[model samples]
Target: MGQHEFSEGVEVSHSQYGRGCILDMIASQTGGIDDARVLFYLSGEEVTVPTYSLAPASEVTSVESTRGTLGTTVTIDDGFYTITVEPDGEGTGYNLSLQAGNAILDQAELSSDKLF
Candidate 1:
């Protein structure tokens, strides 16, 4: 749960590619490394990069936080999705709601034990 992990339609700058918008963010498995395969609009090629390497673009809107709790809303990439974290009785329990413009596409209830 780092800041700006990756999201669609977010503007960003690359070390080599200069400037681009993130078209997609897909999980990649190489050498057992959980990396993010990002597609940049400028290069038009999907490349894997560490989440820490990306620089946020000034134009695209994003929400990032080091601290979050119930009723907290985490928005990413100009409203591509809104993730809500709900409170639960168990200290480790987590209930998430994923929304797509007033339409909830998915919801899940889990505990810290379920998530590594």
Candidate 2:
């Protein structure tokens, strides 16, 4: 892909890292695309990678959500990332989680109103 500028919070994909969200970006001191880099969060870890090696997260061309007896599961994968919402064991609320492959980046319990 051609060199392009990216800002914080943008989701990007790398050939080696899969999908990640940009946490910060450092401009090249020499104003060279080869030197510019970005700090991104991937699989629960923060990593810095060269901008040239990344591209805007491959478009999420297909998304699927299924509701079953167990819970609701949503898959939005450009070959990465799955989000899940399930009833809290207590039956009081729903638990939401964001996952990339096997890494759970965030999980939270939400009340009915918050979930809907």
Candidate 3:
């Protein structure tokens, strides 16, 4: 997949899974190796899945209308990633959020970005 495939505001579906909305896409160094990561909400749970395992957004046919929002920005030793909340703008703070595993290696903020 190209870098543009990880763009914000994209919807996708997985094989054997119902559907999921793309929250944040980031690249980071893991154990001296670079890896692409994609964070998304699945079945009301926050899941951080590898970008390589994700199918193209167009191939997903069971996509839902639910959208995601950028909640916060997090930075670690190797790289940085963002926190995302589902269902768009809903409250003053994020009740649920997800971040890349590599991005949570250090202290970071939750809900750094405002919901639009």
Candidate 4:
């Protein structure tokens, strides 16, 4: 059995877009591709992006965090959601916005070994 490590509300950064936060992660066992659904709020607007497009912030700058101060940005896939990171002086309370996207109707579909 393979141990899968997944996370929610993770920090991320993007190329075309600036910085953002991760709302959720969807992984495919066959391709080993992890898709991180992200939300970014910019100019009073919310946008959603994917994980593959996100780049680490720590790679851009140095910061402190229990998680190694790693950050990433997700590119907007849809125009419904936005991305924003609230930086408290104490470093807490980080919220990211995610626009609605394709829905996962059946849980069984995720477990199926067949890719298509």
Candidate 5:
């Protein structure tokens, strides 16, 4: 995925998943999104999408869109992997990452169209 321009507090709308909020971003130590990923909270679940399939959310009304939640750094451990969720600003957007040491597992992002 290329460089994506988005704030830390903005709602993202997907063409398939409807409306969701950007939870967080995982960039390289150099702040590069080469293997970066984002966590999105949509449909009552946290989904990981690639940064390439991202776009800003439009100001349109839709039934699938639900008001996203905002919060501070939330961490969850499933024994094997440790997960963290940090929301952006007081609105939505934040950063979500999954990695083991210096290796990146995956990266996700938000957008204004379908992800499938």
Candidate 6:
């Protein structure tokens, strides 16, 4: 519910399901987490579990985040949605896009307001 404390790409462990990666969180009309789609590693099957039923996997050792440099694009594609980040054509900032299926969920230009 509300904004999820956990996000996509987080590895989670369930009491009944063992270890898995969060594929997606289904959002209700009210913008709360209805449930989570988790792909259990042992079964290789996606399971729908309540958001509260999942816990962060403690066995996670390291995490490597990705970022795109100028004139390049970085994309993260989960089965449920895709997020893309690229340098804005104007050179002022980066363009970020979130898309699900063929529908664009949101797009924005990201930049810092501080002058260095």
Predicted candidate 1 versus true structure: per-residue lDDT over 1-116, tens digit per residue: 24444577766765565446666565545443344556766458878776566777554356664345453434453434467665454566767777756889899887876776
Q: What is the lDDT of candidate 2?
A: 0.67
Best by lDDT: 6
Say which prediction, candidate 2 or candidate 4, comes out ahead on TM-score: 2
lDDT of 4 by residue, 55-79 (tens): 6544443322333243332333333
The runs of at least 3 residues in candidate 6 whose Cα sits more than 4 Å from the true structure, single-residue gaps closed, are 1-3, 59-116
Q: Write the residue-wise lDDT of candidate 2 on 1-116 in tens digits.
A: 45554777777777676777877767667865442234444556677787777778755435778786656656565646677777665656677887877999898878765655
Indicate whether candidate 3 or candidate 4 has the larger lDDT: 4
Tell me each candidate's RMSD, in Å, in order.
13.3, 6.2, 15.2, 19.2, 19.2, 12.9
Candidate 5 TM-score to native: 0.36
Model 6: worst 10 consecutive residues (lDDT sum): 59-68
State residue 108's C-alpha deviation in candidate 1, in Å.
Answer: 1.0
Q: Which regions of candidate 3 are displaced past 4 Å?
A: 30-42, 62-116
lDDT of 1 at 1: 25
> By lDDT, is 1 or 5 better?
1
Per-residue lDDT over 35-62 for candidate 6, one digit per residue giving the tens place of the 0 to 100 score? 8899988689999998887767753223
Q: Each prediction's Cα lDDT score?
A: 0.60, 0.67, 0.44, 0.45, 0.49, 0.73
Clash totals in order:
0, 0, 1, 18, 14, 0
TM-score of 1: 0.35
Identify the runs in model 1 with alpha carbons over 4 angstroms from their true place: 1-58, 64-77, 112-116
lDDT of 5 by residue, 5-95 (tens): 5544555655455456666665667876532233444357666665555555553321221234564565543222344455554453556
Q: Which ten residues in a row have the lowest lDDT in candidate 5?
A: 59-68
Q: Clashing residue pairs in candidate 6, if any? A: none
